[model samples]
Each structure stands twice: as structure tokens, then as C-alpha cells.
Target: MPKMVFIETDGTRREVDAPLGLSILEVARRHDIDLEGACEGSLACSTCHVVVAPEWYDLLPDAQEDEEDMLDLAFGLTKTSRLGCQIRITPELDGLTVKLPGAK
Candidate 1:
């Protein structure tokens, strides 16, 4: 299992341990975190947008072009923005922290 910390737009945080192989979106759903994956991880929408912590952002693989396209529609895009569904949990991603973007 690995631990993930989610920071809300208002600065609240939730830390939880999740099994390996779960996507960041899945982890949020399991803990009732407020991540809206409108396409249910299908990559069809940008509702699952998250701001990756700078320290952990570099650890994630680069996003595909389609993901980059969807992120363009996200509300608060940043240098380290990423779609939650596109990020899967793995040993290398342990201790990951992401921030939920403000409402669109």
C-alpha cells in the first residue's frame, strides 16, 4: 500500500493509504474526496484535473497529447497540472500529493 495526500482548494487535506494499481481518481473516490471524474477515467473530460505537487510532479510520466488537449479546458491549469485518471498508483508514486482545482 501507498499513502496519498489530497489538498482541497481551501487548504484542507486528507491523507490515506491505498493499494497499488489504483489510479489517482480511484483513490479520491474511495475516500470520498471531491474529485469529479466526469468521464469516469475514460479521458473524455477534464473534470478530474489536479495540480500535482511540484516535488512529485516530475515523477509522473508525461501526459499523452489527448490528455494535454483536455487539460486545456480545465479551470486552473498550471505548469504541473494533470488529469487524475491519467495517473496510476505505483511504488514510485508513493507519498504523492495533489490539489483539487476550484470549481469550473
Candidate 2:
């Protein structure tokens, strides 16, 4: 199992042991973490935007042009930002940490 940390906009943090290959969005939704998936992981909405904790940013693949474009519309954009649906969990991301931006 891969472990992931989610820091909510209200400052609440939760840890979950996720199955491999699950998207970050999937993990969040499974734990009822309140992440909005307006586009249902279709790469059409910025509601699922989240910031990868600095230390773990390099652990995931870079965002693609579509994800990047969507991220540009997200609130509280940061250098470590990524679309949760675009990040597939892997063993290397066992300790991944992410911050949920204030909802738009």
C-alpha cells in the first residue's frame, strides 16, 4: 500500500493507505476528503487542483499541457501544483503529501 497525506483548506490533515495506481483524486474521494471533481477527472476542471508538498513534488511526473492549462485556472496556484486526477499513485509516492487549495 502507498501512504498519502492530505492537508485540507481548513488545516485538517488525514493519512490514507492507498492501493497502487490509484489517482490522488481517487484516494481523496475514497476518504471523503472534500475535493471537488467537477469534471470527474476529465481534465476539464480545476476543482481538483492540489499542491504536492515540496519534498514530494519530484516524486511524481510533470503535469501535461492539458493539466497545466487547467491548473492555471485554479485558485491558489503554486509551483508544486498538480491536478489530483492526473497523479497516479505509485510505490515511490508512498509518503506523498499534498495540500488542498481553497475551493473556487
lDDT of 1: 0.91
TM-score of each: 0.95, 0.95
Q: lDDT (CA) for every model shown?
A: 0.91, 0.90
lDDT string, candidate 2, 2-94, tens digits: 799999888888899878998999999999998888999999999989988989998788889999999999989999999999999888889
List candidate 2 stretches off by more than 4 Å: none
- lDDT for each residue of candidate 1 in 61-94, tens digit (9 for 90 to 100): 9999999999999999999999999999999888
Score residue 26 of candidate 2 by CA lDDT.
Answer: 92
Report the alpha-carbon TM-score of model 2 versus the true structure: 0.95
Which candidate has the top score in lDDT?
A: 1
> Candidate 2: deviation at residue 100, Å?
0.6
